[model samples]
Target chain A: MANEVAADANEHGSGGGMPDPMHQFEIKRQVELDVFGIDASFTNSSLFMVIAAILISSFLIFSMRGRALVPGRMQSLAELSYEFIASMVRDNVGAAGQRYFPFIFTLFMFVLFCNMLGMVPYTFTVTSHIIVTFALASFIFLAVTVIAFARHGAGFLQYFVPKGVPALLLPLLVVIELISYLTRPISLSVRLFANMMAGHTMLKVFGSFVVGLGVLGGWAPLAFMVAFTGLEILVAFLQAYVFAILTCIYLHDALHMH
Target chain B: MPQLEIADFAPQLIWLAITFGSLYLVMARIALPRIGMVIEERRDRIASDLDQAEQLKQKTEEAIATYEQALAESRAKAHAIAQETREKISTELEAERMKLDRKLLDQTEAAEARIDAAKDDALSQIKDVAATTTEAIVTSLIGGKLTKRDVSAAVTKALSE
Candidate 1:
């Protein structure tokens, strides 16, 4: 996509040879795949997802091959990630959320790896897509709702009905609560997607500026790009953290119903 | 934008499900439990080590107490034995001293009796000598041929007066 945009701009002599900053997000088919006629073509996005998964698995499985009581560097990383999510669940959702730790852990590692991988030159970011993040958020929303209903039966609906409100204002408040409750997945998904997309797009744009400006003038945008790249990496980790912690909070609400 | 392109969404979701699901399995089945086991094993090891140390400490205390008790008992026994031996020796010494006193008293009495007898014999010998001398003088002064018996009788009478 970046190549197409660069080609078009050069032909028209309009963009002054600046590649499309949005082009990095374009998906490319790696292997043509069809399942039940569903266009499940394996694209660069899927490939990165697979890479993220494999990397996460290998990092976890192989680093712990020693299972040393005193951990080495890789093992410490694995355990640190494990304990990080463990304590997150323990603190946010209490012990009842322990069973959901693997899911939360996978989610955090997946998003973090994808974001970090996207920072590398010419790698597709899986979390930068809306569908992916939305799918995850919706799944969590549905699961949390199911869990709440399963645990509390009909009392789960009482979550939206605030206590101690006058009957006249109760209906209005209930509608507002229901809307907010429904928007959880949207907010969760957009927060991750927007942060990733905007950061990458901005980096690409600044990177193009560095290329457009020759050596004598390029240093300014290049320096800004360097600092922005660092910020993007931090955002990558922070967004993943935010994603997992929000899931924990949702799970907490579902389990305890407050 | 490629993200809004509807054609890529299905594949992306499919792979997301596949990879995420498998990742969860790997963690749940293999990786996480191993880490938990290592931590659990370390904790158990430390706890058992502490327990063993406590037991050993108690054993040392018990041994020290036993040793002190034995020391005290032996010390008392030695004191009692010394007291008994002192009493026995004192009684034996008193008996020996009484026997020695009796032997000295008997020897002194025998010696006194012998001295008295010797003094009496010497006095009698002295009287015989006196009588003989008196008779001899009388016979020399008075007439030659006086009878020994008469002289002896006269001497006896004078001695008597």
Candidate 2:
């Protein structure tokens, strides 16, 4: 998506020859490879995902090496993240969700790290891509559906039919409920991807303004960029929280069906 | 937009699967459980510490109770000993007093006997004196002296009257 915009900017001869704001989102192949003829080339996006994985693993694993009775700063951070997700599962999904803590925790850390890493200059925002978010969302949707079927069997379909509705309107309500239910993945994925992409794009646009405007006039946009960066950081954390919490909510719906 | 590039999706998904799957394994197998164990261990340690504290407190209370019991027992014994000693002294004093009273009574009776003997001796002397004086007077008046026996008998009759 950003590659197309960068090309357009290049063809148009960008105003003041400023770098394309969309160029940062371009997917450049770092190590081209063929995995069973599948073009599984290693790209900047893959690099960041690997970095996110490594950072998350190392942060959680190494920080907890001490296992102190009284936690230190890093250890406290690790514990706080753990408890944060743990409580999210407990509060949103109940005790039944305890078994799924690791998965939820992983999803949160992955998305959180990706979003945060993207905030750094010259880093690719993996979650900015719709496909990535869609993958995660669809996986959650599939897992939740599987869990619903496993737990409630055919009774899971009853979730579409609301109780206390007029019998005459039941068919219409069921169809609406089914549509909404089917759109869960789309909504979930787009919500995260849109937020990440939009925030980053806004930051890039303002950054270009800062560059295009000379030093005297650039301060205004520069200041806005600073404040907006803070907000983007907040949005980054919030989106990850939303992603994980929604997963919990969906799991709750799947498990409890109400 | 590179995001819409279907060509990039495969690699991204493949890497995502590799990285995310491996991360999940690390978390589930190594990282998460270690954290959980630490937390669990801390909880257990705290619970055991509380149990130990409670036990120590109970022991302290028991020790205090025992000390108090011993103190009360000794206090009662001390009271009993003092009471016994006081009663023994009182009885001893009473016996000593009774002995002194008997000795005083004996001394008074002996002194009275001595006084009576002294009075009797003086009275005998007075009779003899009276007999001697009467003989002298008769001799002087009638040119003759009465016998001692007679004088004694006359003195005795006068003393009796």
Candidate 3:
């Protein structure tokens, strides 16, 4: 479920001293820590994650400080982000989901900042790691499961069984729903992690080719790299959006069991 | 990639949890509430301002109406005063004309009476002179004394002729 295997790139390391395509994703320890055999050392990855968090908070807090009747550009961006997540939760989870706006909005901004920060020349993509994405997805999955059980009791099982099915097809349908339900964390985590990992790997791969081919022969891959980078930037935003909306959907399922 | 090394997982997960939770705290506690409050405040201010404007407009309209009503009432009062003055002056003028006419009439009657008196006096004087002259002429011619009654009768007869 964790796409932690490094891409095959040692063969292409002939461009001496040129960093590996997957090297940008590596976690290098910055501040070491060990708590009862747990390696909770702060790394470059940790630094970037904290930076993303700080950036999101500052962007929201400072930009909206003036609170103008007519919003300025920075304020508009801040308000747009607020309404975007608010409406996303409202639409997917209904009016009952207003209480969860903060969490959903936070998750969205955190993932969005992480992805966008990765697009910068040197920042690490925290969501690109299985450990991080899986942790987030598993938390959502567990919370939804608990909520579904608490809210609906044993009636939550009706979600997997569905309604008005042929008795012959009931078992088949239930099995399918249960498997699909079990795969939520794996699918959610893998989706964001793969999109980012693949997009970054591809960009580096093409970049390596561009350097390897020298000046005149590099235009093709360079153009592709440009196009791919644009696509990756779009993917970065889209992946965060997809992840947040899916969480809302799960929450809706938990609340409704329909 | 060090991500594959599995040893890095603990560090990244710990940081992710701490960073994400802190961000959530900031958003929930400070950022969102401030923004919502500002928006709500702006909406309330606009609503109150509109209400104030509406009230002012209605008050202005009422004031204008009262002013116009007062102006119209004053205009009507002025017309009544002018009309009353005009009527009073006309009645006074009419009375003065009547008085003057009566005075002129009295003076014309008095002048006529005095002329009649003077004409009567002159006529009597002229008759007396004529009588005296007749008597004197008769006596002078005839050289005889006449009785006063005869002379008078004779004069009267002659005047009559």
TM-scores for the candidates: 0.82, 0.92, 0.79
**Lowest summed-lDDT stretch of 10 residues in model 3 chain B?**
B151-160
Error of 3 at B107 (Å): 3.4
Better of 1 and 3 by TM-score: 1
lDDT of 1 by residue, B32-107 (tens): 8987787778789889999999999999999999999999999999999999999999999999998988888888
Alpha-carbon DockQ of candidate 1: 0.62
TM-score of 3: 0.79
What C-alpha lDDT do the candidate models reach, one value each?
0.88, 0.92, 0.87
Q: How would you encode candidate 2's per-residue C-alpha lDDT over A1-258 as one tens digit per residue?
A: 996676767634473475566667778899999978898899999999999999999999999999999999999999999889998999999999899999999999999999999999879999999999999999999999999999999999999999999999999999999999999999999999999999988998888788778698999999999999999999999999999999999999999997
Interface RMSD of every candidate?
A: 1.0, 0.8, 1.3
User: Where does model 3 sit among the CAPRI classes?
Assistant: medium
lDDT string for model 1 (A5-54, tens) is: 76567534387666767777878888898989888888999889889889
- Candidate 3's residue-wise lDDT over A1-258, tens digit each? 133332234434643555477777777788899989999998998898889988988898889878898899999898888889988998999988888899999999899999999999767788878888999999999999998998899989989997899999999999999999999999999999999999988988888889888898999999999999999999999999999999999999999775
DockQ of each: 0.62, 0.75, 0.54
- Kindly give the stretch of ten consecutive residues in candidate 1 chain B with the minimal lDDT sum: B122-131
Runs of candidate 2 exceeding 4 Å displacement: A1-18, B126-144, B147-161
Select the stronger candidate by lDDT from 1 and 2. 2
RMSD of each: 4.9, 2.9, 5.0
Which stretches of model 1 miss by more than 4 angstroms? A1-15, B86-161
